[model samples]
Target: MNDNTSMGNGASQQNHLNGQWQGQPGQQGQGQYGQYGQPQGGYQQGPPQGGWQQAPQPKKKNWFLRHKILTAILALFLIGSIASASGGGSKGSDSASSSDNSSSDSAAKSDDKKSDEKKSEKKDEEKKDEGDKLPAVGTPVRDGKFEFTITKVERGKTTAGSNEFLQETAQGEYTYVYVTVKNIGDRAQMMSESDQKAFSSTGQQFSTDTSASLALDGDNDFFLTDINPGNQAKGILVFDAPKGTKLTQIELHDSFLSGGVKASL
Candidate 1:
């Protein structure tokens, strides 16, 4: 019996070492049966044998996907801003181009106006030159202090003095021109024979032959003679030139330095 008891005690110790629990003898309490083999206020049991399974984390929605309306509104605003900027730039370029074109047009108009004015002034000058041309023959013309009338002309004379001692012969054939001079001024004015001039058809100028004019028979030769105002003088001017020299025009002046009038011969 002692050997059996020792064997039972050893078996109980061996059961405790092997993590096996056994009920104590005579310790059965009906009210405490719910607390049987449970430790008091100790650590809870570990997780199950399959290892811990992490709960599926709540899935986070993408920011843009969650706020679809706000995203669309932002995209539209960006597009409108770009479009407005582009439109404003185009408008500025067009406005600058228009201003440059307008300035060019104004410059063109100003140039045209200047050109027109120049043309008008040139036409006026031309008209004035035309008005200053000499008139025809047989018309009485007034120079500074006198009015001259060319009456008639005679050509081909050789001898002129009445006296034999005072006779004068022509180097070339002598031509005679008849003229009437009238002093229309307030003072006396001299009719000078030297002031008369003749132009040939070839534009050659001929001066008066004063020596031949002084040798004339009568007092009808034009010399340096003064005539009273409102009086007239008739004279013949002597011009000596080579034979067959046809005089085309005569220029007559009131004084030595006066502006002359031309008459067709």
Candidate 2:
């Protein structure tokens, strides 16, 4: 009886241990789904068919490659800044200098224009002073101390005479040039017959005849005579110009100091 009891207890203990292990999981690693539908620690398990896949990690980018254009621009800007600082680019300064030069040129041009204008004005004044009188015939010319007018001119006379003087024959044909004169000075002015002159077209100059001029006309004769202030004298001046000489112009003078007046014949 004792032997039978020991064998039965031993068999029951072995079966209990086997049942405990088989109830939890199979010992061979639970076939394809290891630890299938089981909880590990405090977490529950998902379906075995759907396996978890790891997400890919992002790759790092090169700093220069990511912003190549911007990086290049920034690098160039840095280099230019350094270069300009060292070399003194002087862009703004150069502009200032150019403006100064341009202003100087403008001022110079203005000065030149003013000089030219002054020269032109001076020339005009000189012309006005020299050409103050009309150059036409039959117009009276008033010089400093005298006013004179030409009335008529007769030529081709051989004998000239008057009651006061003996008749005289001209070496050449006589030319009678009639004129009127007025003394504009405050005092009496003497009219000189030698001061009268006539020019020929052949460039010959002839002076007035003293004797022939006195015998020219008794109505009015002017030669060596004192003309009172504001008084006038009319007379004919005879000249022995060369024969066949064409008269051109006549010049008259009031005194030795007079700048003579010229009138075209």
Candidate 3:
């Protein structure tokens, strides 16, 4: 009985050992499966947390990109606008300067022209003043008989067919001389034969004893015209003197005297 009891205790101990070995393998496999399942939950929590951080990063990147593009465009536009404004200002200044120069040149030319015109006018006035100082010609002598006050004298030709009754064949040289003659004393003077002959000794013959009659002397061929009281008679006398003659005396005939006094020219 003691041997049978010791053999039963040994078989029981062997069976216990085999069962522990088999259960250990199963427990280890189950623990490994449980650990894989728990890792799935941990992975879901990690995705949620990381998704929040990534979402803000994409938004910030998009905002930064848009802002940079806008700033570049604004800077380029400002540069172009400044260049255009500067060019326009330069053109305006040049135009203004050109206009001012043109106006100044025109004003200068106008002033010069005005000055020239004034100078010309002044010169003309001076010339006119000089001309006024010259002596006059064809001065009258006396009412009836006329004589010349000679500053210059010239010799002339005598007319044909004249009676050489006067003692002096040639005319006298006189610087100044007066001629006197009688008026017809009456309303009219009749021409006698001798008077007509003597009068005809002049170059031109009187047609009638009219107040306005003209006669020329044959001796020197001097011109003579008849006159009444207050009537102006004129005659030309020849001189042998200088060119520009200036007469200084004038003489008239009195009622009683047939001889004339000296006169001025």
> lDDT winner among the candidates?
1
lDDT of each: 0.78, 0.75, 0.39
Higher-ranked by TM-score: 2 or 3: 2
Q: Write the residue-wise lDDT of candidate 3 on 190-235 in tens digits.
A: 2111121111111212211211111224322123333454333333
Residues 1-265, model 2: lDDT tens digits: 8888998898888866654444334344333333573332233457456787879999988998899999999999999999898666577678888999999999999999999999877865654443344354567887767888887888899889855357788898998778888999899988886887877654468888887876655744465678999999888878887688866678889976788887766
Instruction: Give the candidates in order of TM-score, highest first.
Output: 1, 2, 3
Q: Name model 3 segments beyond 4 Å from true.
A: 1-70, 130-265
Q: Taking the tens digit of each residue's C-alpha lDDT, what string does model 1 give over 107-209? A: 9999999999999778656544543354444568888888988778777788766778877788878888888889999999889988889876655789988
- Model 1 clashing residue pairs (backbone): none
Which candidate achieves the best TM-score against the true structure?
1
How many backbone clashes does every candidate have?
0, 0, 21
Q: What is the C-alpha RMSD of each candidate to the true structure, in Å?
A: 15.2, 15.1, 21.3
